[model samples]
Target chain A: MKGQRFLGLGYLGPYIIGLLVFTAIPFFGSLYLSFTKYDLMSSPDWTGLANYERLFTRDRTFFKSLNVTLLYVLLTVPLKLAFALFIATVLNYRLQFIGLFRTAFYVPSILGGSIAIAVLWRYMFATEGLVNMALATIGLGPIDWFGDPTNALLTITLLRCWQFGSAMVIFLAALQSIDKSLYEAAAIDGAGKVRIFFFITLPLLTPVIFFNLIMQMVQAFQEFNGPYIITQGGPLKATYLLPLYIYEEAFKKFNMGYASAIAWVLFTIITVLTLIAFWSSKKWVYYAGDKRS
Target chain B: MTDITTSNDLTMDETARAKRRAGLRLFSTAIRYALLFLVGFVMLYPLIWLVGASFKTNSEIFSGAGFLPQNPTLDGYIKGWQTSTPYTFGRFFWNSFLIILPKVIGTAISCTMAAYAFARFDFPLKKVLFGSVIAILLLPNVVTRIPQYILFRDLGWLDSFLPLWVPSALAGDAFFVFMLVQFLRSLPSDMEEAARVDGANSLQTLVYIVVPMLAPALISVCLFQFMWTMNDFLGPLIYLSSVDKYPVSLALKLSIDTTEAFEWNRILAMSVLAISPALIVFFAAQRYFIEGISSGGIKG
Candidate 1:
């Protein structure tokens, strides 16, 4: 057992080296770097709290980007999850050509994160784009997706929400694993579909929902490609997600220290949100041991 | 009206009820299919339009929202392939492949080993190490980006593919490790134990036994690594400076930046090509891909 203890390190050698170099060292190194002023050209100069002070007190763009990021996450995560669950439920029913429909739903998610899709989204939401033309055909005038901040944000959210296939696929698996007897019993008791979904199915599926929520929230928080490509966080900085801000600060402007601070703040937000989700999961997320099947 | 229920003299009420039930079922099915088709169309329209518009003449790209071109041409594909940059799209694809091949292969091998150690054996600080693995899993990669960049810069790896794939090669991506760990835990350890009884070392057991069993999960890891590396704009954007070193993702963006009036068709054509690798791999290995995602979410 003692020999095996050391021997385990042999197997884990590459991962350990990676974890320290990439994750551990950098994770804490950034924390230290956040306190000092550093540009790529020079060594970090000690300036404790200056970067953070500016961020909290004077940096207007920080708050704007922060607000945009929070709103983006708030809008995208729930909408995506809800859309996914809705679709998953629909697809769960035994229908002809179900696999085709499933493929159609899922294809977007596989490609959604690519810069290619982001570029595509940019064109599709243009003033004279297909979306507007489609709306025109319906007698509704063109909605300037990029001109209005809300619409622009919604447009990006739709891009995120459009790729709900992976989450939907996960939900489908969970839904399928649900005991048929539970549904049969509910039907025998004269419960309606909606009622059964709410009382029985939903509660049982909370764990998966919780899982999807955390995953989607993290992804949404770090959303860059769509906002970056479509508007470049533009038309009045309406879509300036924190990631864009951080990227600009760190790379474009070379404010490494400030960028690190912003990155830390973003990290703190995710960690807290994730911790809250975990704490809250105790109340709602049910672990069905053998009951899942 | 007969009080007794008989096939010969079916009650009028029961007949009506059965007919109504049948009608309701049929109606519901119709509604479900209608909704599915409507939303599924919404989900797929952008991609469909991308492909359709890729073949359109530049003049006809903004002609209307319809995906079909009035006069379709391969002009977009032809010009997009011969990008304005000194290097063509093939160079960018090769660069992306270079990064993806190493990263995917590394992730499959390194992550499987790490997952094996964490899942199977008792080690010193195993709990702590595993805890950190989960912590790193949740930790935002952005937080580490700057410092890691500096580290790589100090290592003189900037402007090269080394910085992009090296860390991942070393198992820096904790999510893959966590996923593999979850998958491994769900598996039986009895096979490895039997291998141990036959005097085979752990590495030999892993190579000869565990890897075969771990094939699906490893394939998922590779596929994910491939797609993510392909999609990654920021990594290459940050690290690679030379035009020749750009990946497809960065190249696509470069096309957008350099082109004054965006040639929508050309951009769309390249977009189609850039996403093709992922799309092809996904649809081909879709069953394992979905199973991998579901198992990670539910079991982990």
Candidate 2:
């Protein structure tokens, strides 16, 4: 211990090196690359704000992708969170086979984001497929799930939302940790179930809700597997999220500089939004974690 | 006589009221379970359909919204296993194993070491390094994907599995490292202190004393890395271009993209195979998975 001022560094060596090589370098490298025009075949040439200017000014696809991504994030995050909370609240009740219900509800979150689920979603929503057959059983006509622009985005959004089980499990943990005495006191005070939930339970749950919001928002922004597989950013690029656009531009179109610019813009957008959430959390997210307090 | 009759009537009324309340409670319980069952069924129906539909013929796959196949067959599984590539589905599964085994093992060792250092040692630049870990956790992979790809390409790491697993092996996943740090912080250091006093070296104490205590958390990390690697589409898609070297995720998609006529049943069959590993593992270790996610809610 006496001669070990830098012994900790020995422990940290591999990680530090990995961090430097894989993360720190690439992070700034992309930033530098964003300002230059580099195709894979040639060396990068300095392009000074040209990519950003073009993206903002002339690139219709860029704007469309941006619009689509924002809409997807906004739509999916709230829906998923709401479903998770609702299910968690219901499942929190003392009931028979509660664990079984929880497992059944959670199975989708594990399998939902996979390529298999995406493929299943594609078929289930296909024209003249299972969904249509079910609709017909009720004497309703078939709705175009992926063929239409509006439906295409909705289909992709549902895939993201179906994986709400993880968020629900988090909420369930937070909910279970709430003091039973608080609920007993609320009942003794002649508070209705709804009243106590809104006044007591909801406030206590804000921290978990905020955490889920941040995690889900990040994921919804970068949804790739669903959109790519199900709609392929199709029905007129309605499902063309920024990640999809990034993939297409960088890999398919060989637009490395432009793609990096898009990626940086994405990073900036997420950072600013997260910052705003943090700033706003002071108003709403109470960290009264200690139940006695 | 009049007083007795009135009291008797009141008792009867009270009895009826209690019975009604009990009936209402039963009804509510029934309603709650019904709703849970309905939602659970709907949530699981797609997976159920996938399994059942995997056995259906190509023509029958789209025949209805039903899950039960009329003439159940193994045709889809058979043909799907053969795949379009010269390499069969077995090859892809092996590739996935190759990636996951090392990646999960490496994550356990590397992240544990880094987390131990961060949690216990007061190294120079500790604050800055830890801050960078959080920053990396928050940073989207999209920003770094291209540069990393290029770097790997430069090092001739492309078209191989090295690029996929090596980063994780080195504790490049800050989320896992941070998770381990959070876990390590919660653990008491008394046993480790005793070991050190007994003249055990840091690594020796880590290997012998700390690891056993950290087993639950380490299991959680390994399971997460395993499932994530299995479900990863983008990594394999980006790095491994050869048909023979494809993981199940890529192999599943290769059939979809490379074929003209959609072999729906075969795809469905392969889809079942793809998700089965995650499903099996999840049920096997449900406790650790939920505990990790609840404690570590930031996993994406």
Candidate 3:
């Protein structure tokens, strides 16, 4: 018994200690700091509800950021997953150069949201960049992709969607796991290709699709790099995401307390959305080997 | 079932069969080609444009016609290398590498050990601790930044690599820990059990038996941490103030800060130089860059 206890401690001590010092302490500490006003100088004043109240009622940028973030999530998640599924379905077909195609499609996913890519995006959308040049070739005048508020969000959306590599890879794995005999059976039943896709593939792929959707949504909600690098909260705050706002508050403005409040709000929003997703998933998601349904 | 109905169906099929087959072939080919073109454009155009722009002179870049550079030159590359002061391309790359190597090693070692403990052992409070780790993934980094910054500040660890590097020694990456735990759990315990039956202690079994089995997972984690830490900008931007300590990412940003009035050729060239190491690393380890979606919920 003593040996087992000691072994357990030996195995767990470093993790526990690290978690306590880094994660647990910071988590609770930040939660506490949300209620106080400290500028990293004097003693923190415990102001009850001031930060929260200010965010909801008074702060203009807070609402702007919330709207921008919501827009980003809504636009990016669905299109990205759909594109991933489409690519996965296409790749599922046995082809001669499938490996090359897969790698080509995946390279962008790996490099797409990187700071380099973001800088690239900035240049591409600049007034005299490639996009405008392409537009001019067909006698269509150039549109300001990053400069215009209406179009800037779309640029970021497209950027997010371009990195559908991870999701595509996941969908591909799921597609591969599906029994070949199922497709054979469908074909033997005189079902056309479209019918087989709808009746067999789509139904079976629902779980992966749902998984990709939720993950992409959460990730899209927390997206920072593209807008931060490309637009920097935009010509008119069009790309001002909540995370960016929180960052600006903390580091740029040195308002740690206010930033903590933004952080907590973002957390609550994510938690609520995640809860809703889990609840709705019971109706839609079909886990294989789960016989309860 | 009548002969008249059968004859009518036969005639109809015979007339349309050839036409329909031709149409189907055309449609499928079109669909395939269309997909090829669209996906190709989406994947390649931006990257190609970036590469093209990097070689373009200022006047040609501002000219902005099509994907090709009408007057492409190596001016940008030359200028990007020469422009920055106190933060040259080679120096920043070395700085970035210095930070990345330690963080990658730290994450791999600490996260893997923690993962093994979580996966194999049935210690007290294991469930709660595991949950806390996963939950921290959702806890936004911004929330913790202030308290962590303060902690580092009080310790006088700010402006040095310690603030960035030390926590990594103590299982800084919960995502990696969670990933390794899931992977370890999926493997059968028979090997370790046999080793234990032969009088191998838990630590011995872990070091010799389990760690060997976990080679691929460890490598993947290491590569991921290397890329992430290499490309990390905000942490280095916030922590390291001195120009000498600035990593390539921060250095690149500093170069681009004067984007409007500054030379575009140099800026783009420097950006290329800054990101090349990560790009090279990623491409080299490209085969193992598996998108393991199932590992998303894992926390260290």
Candidate 4:
């Protein structure tokens, strides 16, 4: 027992110290500071619910940013996951260069979140950029891409959807795990390809699909870079995502308390959404080895 | 078609069904190629535009509105490099390397240490602490930024890269720790048991036996940290004030924010430059990345 104690301490000592100083402390500190107004240099003053109240009633842009973020989440998550699953299905085929194709698809996702890509997004969608050029080629006269509020949000969402690699890879892994014999049986019973996909692949893929959905929704709510760089919260605050709104409020406006309130709201939103997703997934998600099934 | 072969002898209806299946197969094959081509084009188009724009003149970039340049030139690269914001583009490149190098090393060492401990040991309150690590993963960075800022400010660590470096050094990357822990758990425990019987301590078992075996996991963690830290805009943007202290990511934003007319060509040029190293690293160590993604996905 004495030797076990010594071994435990020796093994976990660094981790314990790190968690205490960095994670546990900061976590509680943030919670406490949410009730106060602190702007870095000045000492925090107790504001209690003032920050939260202001966020709900006084700030109009807060609501706008919320709408923008929710819209982004709505637009990006379904399209991205659908596209990823589509690509994963394609790659699951017996292709000669499957590995190469998989790698090629993944590179964009890594590059997708980058400053360069965000910059590239802005450039590509700009009035005189390649998108307009392509429209010109089809004799469909150039349309205002980023200049219009509707197109601006759509453009950013499309940029995010393009980086569907992580979800695709997940879908790939899930697709590969599906037993081939089920498909064979379905085929023997004269099931069409489309029917087999709907019955077999789709049912089997529900868990991964749910996982990707929850993750993407959480991430989409926190979308900052694309809007920050491309639209700067926009032609009319159209592309102003919640995270960007919090950042501008905290740093640009120096309202840390208000920003913290927004942050808390974001946390609540994510928790509620995730809970809802999990609850709904019970209808669709299937575990392979479950006796109940 | 293949499945039909596995079935018993075909009757008249089955023969008719087989003919229909062949026709459907040919039709589906054409649709498959069409879908593949459409998806491929959608994925590849933006990157091609960026690459093409990088070689065009300011007028060509501005007026062409096309993927291919009317008259391509390397002039954008020259101007982007020579006239980028904050400093010459060279300094931004150096800043990225300086920051990413330390971060990669620090995260690797600390995360692997903690991962090894979690993998090898069964201590008191193990599940509780691991749960905290998982909880922390779900708490978005914004929720913690304010208090972290206060802590840094009180310590007078603001405006320095110390905050970024210190957290990594102290092993605050719960995701990496959890990932490496899972990978280490997947490894056979018998070798360590053998080492334990041979009179080696936990530390010696970890260092002499486990560390050498966990190289692939360690390398993947390092690559992920390197790319994430290198491309990080928010952390550096919030912390560092001075232009010289700005990493390439922050500087890239500054290049646009400071510009009056939205210089498209220069931004693309700088974007290409900033993205090259991570791209190169990704291509070089891609195998490890694929493993990391798969393992991390299931665990995450």
User: Could you say which candidate leads in lDDT?
Assistant: 1
TM-score of each: 0.96, 0.95, 0.91, 0.92
Q: In terms of DockQ, which candidate is strongest?
A: 1
RMSD per candidate (Å) reads: 2.3, 3.0, 3.7, 3.6
The reply for model 3, stretches above 4 Å from the true place, is: A291-293, B1-30, B64-72, B259-262, B291-300
> Candidate 1, residues A1-293: lDDT per residue as tens digits?
66988888888999888888888899999999999999978899989999999999999999999999999899899999999999889888868988788878888888888899888888888898889988899999988999998899898998999899889988999999999999999998999989999999998899899889988888888998989998889768899999999999999999999999999999999999999999988888898873542
Clash pairs for candidate 2: none
* Cα distance off (Å), candidate 2, residue B204: 1.3
lDDT tens digits by residue: candidate 1, B154-247: 9999999999888888888888898899988888989999999999998999999899998899888888888888899889989999999899
Evaluate residue B133 in candidate 2 and report its C-alpha lDDT on the 0 to 100 scale.
Answer: 89
DockQ of each: 0.80, 0.66, 0.45, 0.57
Backbone clashes for every candidate come to 1, 0, 5, 1
lDDT of 3 by residue, B1-300 (tens): 699999999999987987897888678766765686688786887766677777877877767644577777888887676645744577877888788888887777788778888888777777888887777655557667778887888899888888788787788677778778878988999999999899998889989999998887788788777777776777886788898888877777777785455478777777666666666776777666764343442111
> In model 2, what is the error at residue A251, expressed in angstroms?
1.0
Q: Which ten residues in a row have the lowest lDDT in candidate 4 chain B?
A: B4-13
lDDT tens digits, residue span A1-293, model 2:
65466888889998998999999999999999999998988998889999999989999998999999999899999999999998898888878888788788888888876788898998888888777887899999989887798899999888887788899999998999999999999988999889999999999899899889887887777889999999999988899999999998898888899999999999999999999998998889877754321
- Which model, 1 or 3, shows the larger TM-score? 1
Model 3: residue A163 alpha-carbon error in angstroms: 1.0
Pairs clashing within candidate 3: B174-B300, B177-B300, B178-B298, B178-B299, B178-B300
Interface C-alpha RMSD, model 2: 1.9
**lDDT tens digits, residue span B139-210, model 4:** 677788877876787799988888788888777777788889889988998998999899997778888989
